[model samples]
Target: MSRCVLLRCAAAAAVVAATLVAAACGGDDTPTDVVLVTHDSFAVSKAVKQAFERESGLTLRILQGGDANEVLNRSLLTAGDPQGDVVFGIDDSVLSRAVGGDLLEEYRSPELSTVEPDFANPDPHVTPIDHGEVCLNVDRRWFASRHVPPPKTLADLILDRYRNLLVVENPATSSPGLAFLLATVATYGDPGWQTYWRGLRANGVRVVDGWEEAYTQQFSGASGSPGKRPIVVSYASSPAAEVIFASKPLATAPTAAVEEGCYRQVEYAGVLRGAHNEDGARKLIDFMLSERFQADVPGSMFVYPVRAGVPLPEAFAKHAIVPRDPLQLPAAQVDANRDRWVARWTEIVVR
Candidate 1:
């Protein structure tokens, strides 16, 4: 889910940029504030924010740059002169764009050693921060009441019995949507994936602009919303969010993730190229990897921290399902095919 947020373009005079360069080159003193530009889904706890500020002696300013795609696109437009010191939420699906554009400074946080080995990036410009799985979430109660079995895999989605029961976000506009699209691509080869999508279109799958609409307004599984569709494309951790945010104690979550066809999405943070506060930016990246921030990640953003051995929240531990074998596509393959795939997908499914 993303809301359009205005990004302030960096348009300072060359003299001003040179002054910043001089300050960065001659600095022992950290800047008073460090800006973090991230997607709308980014969140942090007040305690963690305060702790980082106290420890680093700098204020952390976060700017929401719509969704992951928007954030990346905006950063590319201002590559050498970024709008913020640090850019967060560059995920595996679109990482090559950031790296290829030279939008980030090369400064691998020492904290990278603490990250899970699977998420380690060979690219030196960014450090992994958090990860999540995008998969189908079914309304358990909806199927139970109707005496119908819930869908368990991508192959089941196009069955006649489940017709018109699923809602998905548009891949061109949403991160989870794009992940789901990539999952299909990984599951089925290029042409085969197109065939599967044709089946989905024939079976009456509905599409929305983003996750918020599909999950909150169209998907019956979501908490406290009267949505008609029984299944939605959303995060594997969404079930935990339901349990954690429930109005009253419930025995179990109403929704559950379908492990098959799940896609792993690992997000990263980097120091923007030519930032005014390079030292502060690096410290902020370190703070994100620290246990204090990592511990708060699950509850705040419904995603798992990349830092190894950080304890999960009780609700998340009990409800969120980590896929045994989540699908993945090489960053290079995805970067090369993303636009073509999205366009082809639109023609087949949307148009």
Candidate 2:
């Protein structure tokens, strides 16, 4: 769900203060706190947080270290002496970089046995929590009002009609942005991806720093005041969020994801190396994989739980899309080429 933090109104301070205040009021004589350092997109209902704290006998503290890339970058800088016990929201887009930098401590959870094999991490270092597809989400209303068909594939984004109608996050700063860039690479390959980016630039695509700005400000399909851009880089599950969070109860979402060029993203959590509360950290990871957590995933974060049998919410079941053949590049390939690709992308699109 962190592919696009679905809670449009919740602020980072609000999420932190709520969790911290609950921990402070807890009646434990000597409370042991396990810190979870993750992206700003992380969210869970208060009930779920209280349940985890009570069940595990651990005070759960959260440290939202910005977006996924910011979280990973901060962890890499303080690799051994991490700021928290567990780090969540590091997806396949940057998982190899985290492992290569020795940012996580290996702690294979028993809960992993129930995870869908497709979402399982082969390495014991990280546990997959949830998965989703990052795709171009369009405002169906916007297209309809203009009497123009929305773009359906990566190739369609560069068309003349869609010019200045698409907004994207900068891959260097955002995970979904990076996943989208990888999607282009997986779709167009090498020189072709570069050409595609050049075409996008020529077609007047707008690039923002992160998902929040692109989706909430520039994207037309968001709940509040609509922006000019009809299409944006966002999650496949975003439509479900739109329907659930709408001002009024709606039968359907105003937005829809173009599944043809979607990119699959699997978010993971792991114990940080040299954590003060390693035991508590492992417990937190296990709790994340528990049914209570996974079951709340769709409503809380707008992502599909990695646990195979977790049922989806009505909104997700009705409005969300699961791409049949989402685009993906192996972690090793992404890790090796990420820097060069980002630099080239900046050159083509930003510079």
Among all candidates shown, the one with the greatest lDDT? 1
* lDDT tens digits by residue: candidate 1, 1-351: 223222222334565776875564454454678899999989999999999999987878899969889999999999989999999999999999999999999988888888888876558999888989999999999999999999889999999999999999999999999999999999998979999999999999999999999999999988878899999999999888889889998779989999888999999999999998898999999999998899999989999998899999888888889888999999999999999999999999978
| TM-score of candidate 1 to 2 decimals | 0.91
Please list the residue runs of candidate 1 whose C-alpha ends up more than 4 Å from where it truly belongs after superposition: 1-30
| Deviation from native of the Cα of residue 295 in model 2, angstroms | 0.7
Clashing pairs in 2: none
What are the models' TM-scores? Answer: 0.91, 0.89
Q: How close is candidate 2 to the true structure, as a TM-score?
A: 0.89
lDDT of each: 0.90, 0.90
